[model samples]
Target: MTQSDFAAPSRYFVDESGTTGDLSRAGAGLDFKQQPVFALAAVGVDDEQGLADRLAQIRTRRFPQAAELKSSKGHATTTVVSELLDAIDALGGGILLEVMDKRFTLAATMINTLVMRPVSPDDHKPSALWFRMQLAEQLHDTAPVEVYDAFIQACRNPGEASLKAAFRAVLQLVPPETPRDSPAGAIRLFTLDSLKDYRKAGVSKPEVQRRFLPLPDLGHTGKEVWILPHLSAFTNLYARINKLRDGRLAEVHIVHDDQPYVAEILRSSKQAVEDLAADNKVMALARVDYRFVETGELTFTASTSSPGVQAADLIAGFAMRHTRDALAGSRPSLESLKVFHRLANTLDGAPGFGMNLMLSNRDVLRCGLLPSQVPPMQPS
Candidate 1:
């Protein structure tokens, strides 16, 4: 069937909260500290109007007064989220729920060591290294092998594991055929405070600076500095979300209590959506905020808006766009064209090739241009 003949994919709404230990200091506040639980939940809605109605019910249940609603309080917030999941499940939609018992400190540590820090040159070693150190400090008598095996297993299959193991156990609650592999229509929920704590504890500014800075003789005098911890936190979150999206979980809607933290994530999400859409030749139809029915809290939804393009279509368009652009405005010999074609075919595994081609100079040069062009067409 043609793309138009297919139904729009189902949508998943996701939100996260309660992962950090010191709630008092976190953006979500002291109440979250008491729970020290971090949760990521997803709920599927049939359509935009249905989503709005459900959110209204959640809002009425959680907050009678819109003015008094705050994003960080766990008690009412938890109830709203729990109720929303129940409603979605009752309606035969999918639900994913995961909760972590570790102190926010420990969870933060794990996120840092596992997800955030590995991309850094200094922390590029196996994830087991830091995990072992943390386990030794916490359990004392536990063997590293046990911890390593558990961690790897959890990462590979979050649906089977508890939030305590991988923080992704919520997926288990979802229906097995929930269409997680769809291009569009997956909703994701996230909490920013937990991510912030993890970033602050796991990464150091000096480390990033050291890696990015060039030696004096290299002629790069200024050091690349990132002062705001939120920058890296959101950046990491964006990467993680895209990873999920690439894996076929679309329609990600995040719920975060901390306004500032949520705001940053929104900003990053907006940029990501725009960049991805533009690079892929897809359009972002809409991003709007609505109240949660249970809590009377406001949440945001980002949608493709139009009926024409599926999420995968957008991705494909981006690839085609880049390929076209790469092939345009250049005169390459037959051999050079062959090399470009081979390189493009090999790198097809790369996500958002069109976007990557446009945004990344390296990919454009490598995939679009001939290798012989390097070093003034020096022979291989």
Candidate 2:
């Protein structure tokens, strides 16, 4: 057998930023918020040792004091991160990313989740009944209007239970080819919070028309059931990986920075992979074999322990800083955002699929870029 048959598969280094925006600081405009976006970034490489060594060289040279490297610092930090990015691309690694502008996440949804969470204050919070009543009132023109209205109000707050019910109410309105008998919580977690890449999830035109009501017409992206900003970023990255290399390798793996909420990440990713492998998701089938996700695995490591994970940390951190700058109307000069953008060219001789962006409608209209130029996944 050829060496290719036995060569170890590439390990994808993944990292994320802004999972929890400053909820206390959330206000009227996106610009003033401390955290305007959430980003998940990854780089794929076959030569794990080589890439790790190169990154160590840069770190040793730039941060000789054994000082920690952070992307939010000054020009010198940019130099370190930019060079590390260059090393990855030079070594034939592929990059993928997803960025979500969270300002578009509806206010009503965030309040609902906050109310349901365990640590919620015991008094003065709006009950689930009141929340549903408002949804029924506001979505009077949408498909769920009748369902929301007809559903009996709860005696008190539904807590986490409301999440499944809200998601179920929405999905039941759509005409499924087969009846959906699954539990509402299962349905919400499996589909809305799915981690499989969008490309692998088979969200093409045909499936969209088949699986969902006119959701966009309802004036929000199913926000009541899911907190989409960060989740979308993770899914988009997974999808992009499948898109670029469907048949080249036996498997793919991930090493990501440790996070407190790792369970959410792992759970969504597993479901995504499982859904892709299911018989009905045709576009997903085109992008990945069932074994790809079924057999694929991931491990989380602290960045200090794993250079690959550290590299991912720098990549995501640098990208998040750029986006935050963009929000505050602070322009990153040639030595900043420009360097990272240039590094991207080394991988595929283009901007590369390493970057995916989602922006609020306000930013979209203000940014001067055409809507067609931006990918459709970002919130409108």
Candidate 3:
């Protein structure tokens, strides 16, 4: 059963953090200080057994209770979290990371549906950035930042009423033309009507200043989340597929953390890639057709059986900490988040290879956590 006895395949171990299935409820259940970002992370290994050995060693020495490796403790202190991340980094495999900005997502999703404005020369599906830019243009330049700052401050260790009032304020800034059944619409209507209600009352109390939308109560709880770890894997693999093809090695086994619904997402992703491969889809990054994926069998196994998955969990914590800090308006420090700025397996000296920052410019600004080495947004 020793790792030295067997050769490992080219595979990725993936895990996720900050997932609240329903997008709107991202931070709905967690305490207000918690991050609302969703991130899926993967650690790719050419030698899986090495990673397993390292993890086993880390657990026995650093994580006494975790030696059994049942499940991640959901949160680890900076020291424990760093030890795990360092172990993964020492393995030398490239890391793949993806972050989802919920605030931007919430606003963007609503604006896309509610606003009828068309782009120049054509009517196409509005992009998240486009929606934000549109709203930013309408604002007094400082409104978005002021509103964003208010929400950030309000959500910090917020109580139920605080959340209601805070989100109601958020709704006011993006209210739709007419009230609708959707939460986005409701928040929008509330966001707008609350302003009206407050103005009519002619009160400037702190409560009135909150611009809260009235709801039945403030103590509702929990929501679901979908973390398509495979999507991160897809991006990771796509970046390397051309190289794999060039090397005449088109096979890769995916190793993922034993999360719910993972197999289905992987299978679905596999099929989609297969279909695209069958059609000879070209990847712009590699400037080659997806022949690599077509020729390869992307067989994946759950992480309960693989040590690589545990290493990927290290990345989950790294992401969790960075996300929380990023939300609080600070970047991850190398002393605290050693792996936050580390870039391995890069292409053309890019800050990330399989690693991707999923947040938009607007949210990044809100968090005040832009790293010096972060890559510029790719031209889509």
List, residue by residue over 265-310, the lDDT tens digit for candidate 3: 5555556655765675633333223444434444555667777766
Least lDDT summed over 10 consecutive residues: which range in candidate 3? 213-222
All candidates: TM-score: 0.31, 0.58, 0.56
| Backbone N/Cα/C clashes per model | 36, 1, 9
- Model 2 TM-score relative to the real fold: 0.58
Candidate 1: misplaced stretches above 4 Å?
1-10, 14-33, 48-86, 90-92, 101-258, 269-380
Give me the displacement of residue 123 in model 3, in angstroms.
10
* Candidate 1 residue lDDT tens string, 147-228: 3333334333332222234322322222345453431112111212323443454434444322211111111233221122
Candidate 1 or 2, higher TM-score? 2
Q: List the residue pairs that clash in candidate 2.
A: 197-239
Q: Candidate 1, TM-score vs. the true structure?
A: 0.31
| Pairs of residues at least 3 apart in sequence or in different chains that clash in candidate 3 | 20-224, 20-225, 21-224, 21-225, 22-224, 171-191, 172-191, 175-188, 329-367
lDDT of 2 by residue, 1-380 (tens): 12122222367888877666322234443342467767777877778788878976886888766654555443236787678766865676656666555543332232223212112233212343233223322332233333332211110223224333444454565445433353333233333442132225454444422222211111123222223454445554555554555433347776777764443445455566557556434222222233333334556778777767767677777766776666668766667656556433334322225455455434433333223232223221
Measured over all alpha carbons after superposition, the RMSD of each candidate to the real structure, in angstroms, is 22.5, 14.0, 11.7
Name the lDDT of candidate 2: 0.48
